[model samples]
Target: MFSTGSDDVGVRKAFFGSLVFETVEKTNGATSITTGIDNPVPIVILFVVLTIVFTMMQIIYRGLKQRRDELLKMSGS
Candidate 1:
C-alpha cells in the first residue's frame, strides 16, 4: 500500500490487481470517499502512441539522411 502523505488517499497492488482510494471534501463540510480498481488501458494506449511517434521519427530521420547523402553524391559528380 502507498499513501499519498495524507490519510485521504492510498494505492495498493496485489498480485495482478491494483486498488485506489481517495477522499474528497465538499463545501458543506461533508466528506466523500471514492474507491476504484486501477485500469491498464490508459497505460497500453500511451505505450502504443509513444511507439508510433518514435517509429515515425526514426523513419523521417532515415529518409532525410538518405536524401542528404544523395544530394552530396550529386554535388560531388
Candidate 2:
C-alpha cells in the first residue's frame, strides 16, 4: 500500500508489476502544467500568411467590383 499522507503534494510515484508511473498534481502554490503553445514563431508565420492572403483577396474583390461598375456605366450610356 502506498500513501502520500497528504493531498497537497506535487508529484506522486507508484509502482506496479515492474512499471513505475509518475503522476503530477497541482496544489496551492505549486507549479501547474503549461497547456499553451510552446513556439510562437510558427503562429506568427501563420498569422502573417493569413493576413497577406486576406489582403490579396480584398484587392481582387475591389478590382472586380470596379470593372463591373465600369461595364454597367458603358452599357447605360
Best by lDDT: 1
lDDT of each: 0.70, 0.59
User: TM-score for each prediction?
Assistant: 0.58, 0.57
| RMSD over all Cα atoms, model 1 | 9.0
Error of 1 at 15 (Å): 20
RMSD of every candidate to native, in Å, equals: 9.0, 11.9
Give the runs in model 2 whose Cα sits over 4 Å from its true position. Answer: 1-33
- Give the per-residue lDDT digits (tens) of candidate 1, residues 5-54: 55553444433454455666678987666667687666677789999999
Which ten-residue region of model 2 has the weakest summed lDDT?
14-23
On the 0 to 100 scale, the lDDT of residue 40 in model 1 is: 67
- lDDT measured at residue 74 in model 1 versus the true structure, 0 to 100: 100
